[model samples]
Target: MKKENIKKVVLAYSGGLDTSIIIPWLKENYNNCEVVAVSGDVGQGTELDGLEEKAKATGASKLYVLDLKKDFVENYIFPTLKFGAKYEDYLLGTSFARPCIAKALADIAIKEGADAICHGCTGKGNDQVRFELTLKALCPDMAIIAPWREWDIKSRDEEIDYAEAHHIPLKINRETNYSKDKNLWHLSHEGLDLESPANEPQYNHPGFLELGVSPEQAPDTPTYVTIHFEKGVPTAVDGKEMGAVELVEYLNKLGGENGIGLLDIVENRLVGMKSRGVYETPGGAILYKAINVLETITLDKESAHLKEQLAQKYADIVYNGQWFTPLREALDAFANSLAKTVTGDVKLKLYKGNMINAGVTSPFTLYDEQTASFGEDEDYNQADAAGFINLFGLSIKERAKLSKSWPKIED
Candidate 1:
């Protein structure tokens, strides 16, 4: 849509550097149009402080801070967990949060009678696709604006310069401007030294690893805890029931303290480029593993195998920003069905970035002690294995017989 047609625009604002500068950039470029800023809060603590006053001071007419943390965990995180989805061990932290944030932007746009929904996602990243696709899905005719693709400002330094000229108060400067995304599930760090694949992460750098310490700096003693799950969703820790937000927060603290979930990888982005990023997903790491440990005895061989295959596909769907599509809904349904049997308790020992399975128990466990016992029993028939082996190996035996005439065994 043309700039003249956009009398009002709703921006998917996060009080971050990219978005903080974007509020001013949109006004200067869009005929000084009415900018309504929507900050979808999914538990990025302290980031939302003084957001409304800041938004207005920066050129936004109004600000809407949507509290989606509980919704994000219950609706997005747990479903992905039940599906056992992981984008190359990433835990779908930033991947899944985009849709949640975009949905809020779309809703606020419609409510405010806005002509366009703008976002601060860059042209080079996956979030641009995630946010735009979701906004388009939810609001088909609403115009979408991505300032990074349209703006003349080429770099973060330029953005800071622009912000300073406009007198926009910012929490960061050019030196500390690492492109980051934080939410209830994880905190992702990109750019800066993390842009290089060969560089080792400064896990011990002060204030670098915001969530917690490195494994080397973690406490020596192990922390053991049992997580209770109902229908594949984590409900409690150490037998104490908690709400979705509380559960994740509690686990995040524990997992962070133990240096449990720090991932450094050069992942294949949806934009057909490899981007190196460091992720801190303390609680999410524990949740994913806990479900895997529970599913060990709860799910049967066929279901488990099929779910694993589907999980790979699901991970791709999420990573590619297809969250609101029918395919995602279908996969979620399949995951929900399989997860029905995934209710159980998983006991794990956390120590220095290691999660060791201590114990697992479920009422629906398929494991039978009697059937798996090594001792001889009156009901067991050892001689029956000969016929079973013959039937099972029939195809291999016939293939060998057919190939015998083709080549000598010695050759």
Candidate 2:
């Protein structure tokens, strides 16, 4: 907590407006401590371009750019997907990536033997809690410094002015000042006109949309995609086998072309405030839908329904930054057990933001079409339903008889 205690600080740098200023701020506030900048690559693509030069130019002693895309999808995104975790209508694209990025930062900090870890998350945002909670869980001895909470600058305008005065090069300006977070899972947009719920999101705004086109701008024809899943994990797209990262990237391109994922919502933040955000999650949407189709065939009545209820708890845990908790691990264990039978292929049609199920097939399906058919079948007898109806409705019949015997009262 004291400035003199921090001899070296590893900062989570994104080369964004806030993080670009954090390097110099850490140097000034920590009594000119050595700053090591770390940028986690969770599929941000060109957003990370020029980050090494930028970090060094902004007063960082050294920089480490970690490629965490494969780890992110396999460990975080896929597990959450198996549990069907969705925070309201959100697919939890941004919520799940924070802990992953923070974990990478913590690992680098330990490797670099840094005394403290720093981030640019503001006090009002949920990311501060997510990043710090992860650090606390992983490396309790490491100190955390959040400059947005300690710094004198209050607003984006003030931060920009400070950046200008300090000669910190920034890619964002006033006109394109929407706060954004991007990873392999999704791209979230906030601030600027998005702060007002009444204003429709500028989906077509320059630099606002990187993943997909708007539904209105999508092609007139529908795009069909076939996905194969093994143990609830997506394995291939259109019969082409790929790794976790490769499959998601492939779907992102296909789904983006069809405008399959776009969400606008005013969600409750972990910081006890409601915030509006627009999100684009082209590939993630396809995965969620496809996996659900496989689940319908594999999971039976009781286990499937119970998992659905537990999924809400799972979503809450991930959204509230409780990824490292025991409950989450236990839940994942249960989900993994249930996913053993969820191996199949699902076909879907994507058209102008709508994902319609074409067909789903699995080896473990409970459906028996022959017995379920209306025509005569060797497996089922019509007389069996009469006995079943009598037994199943016995309690209801008794209740009705008792009600008939009771005296009627005037209202």
Candidate 3:
């Protein structure tokens, strides 16, 4: 990578410490290659305000704030949710959003005719792998530059000092020490005391939460709500149709009030180290629960079982940053097939941080009242179980008899 030939470079800027410092660092190291800052608005509310102006102040030639919220929720979040994929029992909300953001950044780099695309992701985290992998999959010809891997600055303290010395305006306070990532789906908090798994997370620690009330602070009264779905995508709340963004926002308000979604886990990063993170996903949790409730009625037994197994694998694949692989696409096809019939209404009871299924109804429901009832008439016979059980257990019964005859003394 020759500095003299490099005319322009695109940077994945978050308006944070690392990225703010990287703009100047790129100029200092790359002989002042024109830096274009690209920020993706996946759902980080007001954090993006004045980003373009701020980028200019930081010595960027221009700034692109791409609004990918609709695409993010529709294309990435919903598809993963339809698979019921949860990485280690916590939804891969963050993992699912990364690739799409990277894609947006790469797309900007190509359209702007930048010579290279750079990212401020740390060396030890998963985002670097996710970002670089997207470039490899989508725009392989583009030069990839990762500042964390190449920069001389080694610590957050050093980066913060650089930002201060260079007059880069990043919001930092003594009260706010945790690193946070926020989008429309959820918010994730890591670093500081969270680096140690033994420490019980301090809610009093600033910036440790988003979108939900603490479980302890949740009201004792239960909140009941109905969520309607069409082809596995949530369409309404309480019988009113809404857009993807509105539906999620509605659910977030309801779920947060009742303390619905919060997760703390020590998860494996793509770089091969375990990191502790706390996530707040109030709306996503409600939607996942409501969708599963609908699927219970809609999906056939075999399809439901298979999809459950596939969900875990899907979660693993996404968590490992394999979003662009063929296997994930194939799995997505299967999930879509199963999701086609997942249309219905689900009523959930939210109380004390729990999402409880209250009622479910779907047009494609496979549940048969006659077969499942205790007072079933012609649909079933009591005598049929005798033969069926005997036939099914024949091999097991023979094996047990042989085992009895060949039994050895146990200690």
TM for every model, in the order presented, reads 0.97, 0.96, 0.95
Assess each prediction's global lDDT (C-alpha) against the native. 0.90, 0.92, 0.86
| lDDT minimum window of 10 residues, candidate 2 | 201-210
Give the candidate number with the greatest TM-score.
1
For candidate 1, report its TM-score. Answer: 0.97
| Candidate 1 C-alpha lDDT tens digits along 326-389 | 9999988888888887888999999999999999999899988876788876666889999999
Q: What's the best-to-worst order under lDDT?
A: 2, 1, 3
Each model's total of backbone clashes:
0, 0, 0
lDDT of 3 at 279: 88
Enumerate residue pairs that collide in model 3: none
Which candidate order results from sorting by TM-score in descending order?
1, 2, 3
